[model samples]
Target: METEDEAVQLPFVGSFDRRDGADALADKIIRTLSFDLQDFRRGQRPGAPKGFAYLRERVEAAGIFVLLIGNLGSHHSALNVELFRGFALADPVAPFVVINDQDSDTAWSFTLLHELAHIFLGQTGVSGSKAGTPVEIFCNDVAGRVLLPAAELARQYDLRDAPQAEVISRIAAIAANRQVSNSMVAYKLFREGLISHEMWAAVTSLYRQQWLQNRNAARVKENDRGPSYYVVRRHRLGDRLLKLSRRMLTEGALSPSKAAAILGVKPSNVYALTETAA
Candidate 1:
């Protein structure tokens, strides 16, 4: 909820397209951020085998991250709020990002990476639509490059003339290895022209239905109470936001009331909220 005055002024004056060297800019930002995909593949760096913890750490370091606890339907799923630290209107380094929590894990992860690309590009706007605008395309390029690198896909499935069965099998194996959904893998393959459009559409539809079914089943099992309060809060706020708020609270730099405000909970609930995030 940063005011217009506090928003980061985009580095670009007008155009946000590949012609503007968006891809090169994205590559530079990735390198500068030190997001080592090779280390992630080796599982020798970052937090754990699953990579979300490491990604969260990098994201929090790059900017202020917030997870909005609400549905955005199939559109308007994520947003970025460019906030400048201090009152310096001239400063435009780091910004803020907010993402919807209603999407399935894979979709959520994709949106997260996409928004991070925006932050790196110094772009600001709501995300989540089927359009192929230049900025959207650029962000998608960045997200795909980082999350499901084309080179990795090439290494995983070297066969260029594989049968349908072999293609599906390879996609499933790669998705499992990457800890991402098969739909994501299929989409990337389609983009890479390694899979046919027909196959991609079929796989995407099947996975979408499967995800919806699983979500409905889980909701019925939970009786609509949803996840525990702390679990929800922890995920919504993320570890970095929680740890920073907790540290500020402990150091007396942030008042309990202010912490509560930032956390969207009562002052008395701040400690408990952060505890759940632990």
Candidate 2:
């Protein structure tokens, strides 16, 4: 539970109960900041860079923090609880912590964006009280509006007497288009009485089981590969920095050591950057 003063710091941004509502907050934030969300969704340069290091740089630049929340007993996993505490300690004012549920990219994306909405609303110190403090409730409402717009979702779901599978398919399609998860869409439908609670629960359970199975399979594959470090993406060094690096490399404005430091690498790795450019 949050104190009255703490609760007052949070702002309500958009509709949270409906399927399309959750995305509203993010949409509003993007627009307010004069940023095009499409720009963030684009592909990076091939073989440019990888790993969470790039992501961390982007988050720092954007004043956001992404925390990966994985299953218990998973080695090298990010713990959500620890992330929450860390963010609280690091930046008490407007700490932005995005949580990924480690279930699937879809779920992770949805939850991350939803949490981002909470940060945009200026809500902090939100404990896991599902009965949720007023501020939490308001944040949830904003998340709903941002993810599922009421009018838009209603129009899409208003087709004649759709079956559960059909409805789920449609919801899944919409979620995919919005870069969110289908379960989030179904949850919204159940909340709106578009789907029964039992149906929603059953679908959720199935997805959970599937996700667990896939994760186990992936673990086996990782074991087979031994210890191999994978670079996920590299363009995350900020567009400005990336351009500057390239220009400096051509004009000799940046030395190899300076370039390595800019990329968050040790001075010894300076050759790596030059080698890549070579």
Candidate 3:
């Protein structure tokens, strides 16, 4: 809520008021952002999609905060990983989205866009991948369309009549290239009518199984060394919030304790955190 008071309000540009066409909404959002988000690879020309860094910057520029938080294995130690993919709160003045950073990069990207869809629709909620509510399905469609457009998906990924191994190989490659998960790829194919529900189910289940295996291994490895304290703190607080804290402190508008409170750090740690963030 302090962030809301500090935020510069921006007008909401979404057109999803009781509308069923998620693709249309997604398209409009893309246009509003003035870039093709699917071309996530960094580009040479102006206004080209520049992957995750660029996306987060643009969302933040649009007056929305995008934060990456720890996952079940790291932060929420007792919960199942599959039960919490992301969270979103829609406010006209201070909409923000959070993605569990402990997930794979592919899952991170999908969850980022999924929560952005909820923000676009001006809704508040938490979600898991298997959520089947109408709102969740609609948000998934919007996110899927932005990441995997129908025409391009058809041309690049024709999974019909392929062998199981080949199908898995193709989807995995697509997921890596498109910066989306195998589950997202299968879901898009099913939504586009290129794959049957059975195919989608089998593919998603396999990916989920693989994810669990990977997550367990990652937990053991990541815990051994762990991320830098400064890096983790900087990411959780985000650049925008950190920058603001520093500016307010410099201007004598914010006290040390208040800055620490806002940044979720100790009073002494606040200076170090802000300097490292810079």
Candidate 4:
């Protein structure tokens, strides 16, 4: 698409009345008459890739390109996975949603929608773990609502002030069903007033600690297994970029090195990466 006007307008955003502020606007978007999330497929993937893929496809279909990157070995310190999650650019000509692939796939579900929230608002900026600013919270609220609707949660779970054990159990079930993190579920509960701020804090803190520990173990296992380079490249580059790169390469419109630059891989790897967008 050459301009934002040329891109396909998402069906859900068409119903916006524009009478409310950001937070209220978010609620309106979620309640769109055309809004239905049943197509967000539920899969048995050990991670959350299945959910992320379905959502990403929908986003790209609406004329935005999604990119994925990782913590560059030693350069991991530079990105600081603890602080940075992802960012979006609401460019009039080429809107882009770039996410850190290094973040857990489950977390990707929340982060992807969060960035999408930015694009819908025509807000261009970075997003991080700490959602302090109004824009960040708005984005967060949109993501949470989409993934775990307040009505659904309240209807399905007790959501009342309860023993820590019961709260933990409730959060886990929702997180697993919604393909999001427990922290996200807790935030939704807090936003819905079903839980106190103190309870939200406790739940989020508990999960953050557990996630870090699990991540450390998974990292060790990954090192032992040594990931497949082509698989990683194919995943990060995504289907839209891979297909475009392949077509351009066949047409001789794009050089191998240029493809590498665009795909964030070496020239030799571009061929394999473009060969399969799975």
Q: Which runs of model 4 end up more than 4 angstroms from their true locations?
A: 1-36, 41-48, 73-78, 156-161, 223-227
Residue 167 in candidate 4, Cα distance off native in Å: 1.4
Q: Who wins the TM-score comparison?
A: 3
Query: How would you order the candidates by TM-score, starting with the best?
Result: 3, 4, 1, 2
Name model 2 segments beyond 4 Å from true. 1-27, 33-61, 69-94, 126-137, 158-163, 223-278
TM-score, structure 1 vs. true: 0.72
For candidate 4, write residues 1-278 as lDDT tens digits: 22213455454432333335545655654453233466563743322376777777766666567888756644344465566788888765557888886666678878888887777677777788667887788778778877776678657544565987888888788777566777887888888888788888888888878887987897777654554777756667667778777877887778999989888778988787787543
lDDT of 2 by residue, 70-110 (tens): 43434565454323312121243324453434446555433
Model 1, total clashes: 0
Summing lDDT over every window of 10 consecutive residues in candidate 1, give the lowest-scoring window: 82-91
Every model's TM-score:
0.72, 0.55, 0.84, 0.82
lDDT of prediction 3: 0.71
Better of 1 and 4 by TM-score: 4
Tens digits of per-residue lDDT for model 3, 45-125 = 222123666666667767777777654335656444477778888877677788766666566656777888887777787
Error of 4 at 179 (Å): 1.7
Of candidates 2 and 1, the better by TM-score: 1
- Cα lDDT for residue 166, candidate 3: 79
